[model samples]
Target: MAKHYRGREETPKTAETPRLAVRYYPKAGKLQLLKRWKDREGNYQVGPGVTLDAEDLQLAAEALELIEEFVGSLGRGGRP
Candidate 1:
């Protein structure tokens, strides 16, 4: 089994809310984006997520910038 460490919760968890968190896998020495959601029984269940490599950090940051620009272009009413 691979050893891993979960970081602080980035988002609040609610019955209808999914969670996003950062996780580190020591064996792989990589960081990953983890998503969790509640099941019918109210148990937190892990969902599929993406593993970010060191080289992809800049690309990820650029994507966020693009998203911010796109959202800004939407204006106050969000109709664009």
Candidate 2:
């Protein structure tokens, strides 16, 4: 059997950016959310942001979408 990283780690949305990272933990049988940010020194940091255990991939995906939209609205000086 081939070892698959997707079952064990977060999937980066892009090679150039870390906008929305997601991972499925086989052990936990749940979907995880990853978030990224930069510090005052301009160094990047990444960490686990959230975990959804309702067993609904669609719900988790929808939540992420709403979050992205809210952030975008905030950037435009609008209500999130």
Position 80, candidate 1: lDDT: 48
* TM-scores of the models, in the order given: 0.42, 0.37
How do the residues 1-80 of candidate 2 rate in per-residue lDDT, one tens digit apiece? 22233443543332224555565565545556768777799877767567655345455788767767877898776676
Report the C-alpha lDDT of model 1 over 1-80, residue by residue, as the tens digit: 23343533343232323587556644444566668878999988875877644444455888667756877989978764
Candidate 2 Cα misplacement greater than 4 A, ranges = 1-16, 54-80
Query: What local lDDT score does residue 6 receive in model 2, on the 0 to 100 scale?
Result: 48
Q: All candidates: CA RMSD in angstroms?
A: 7.9, 8.0
Name the lDDT of candidate 2.
0.58
Best by TM-score: 1
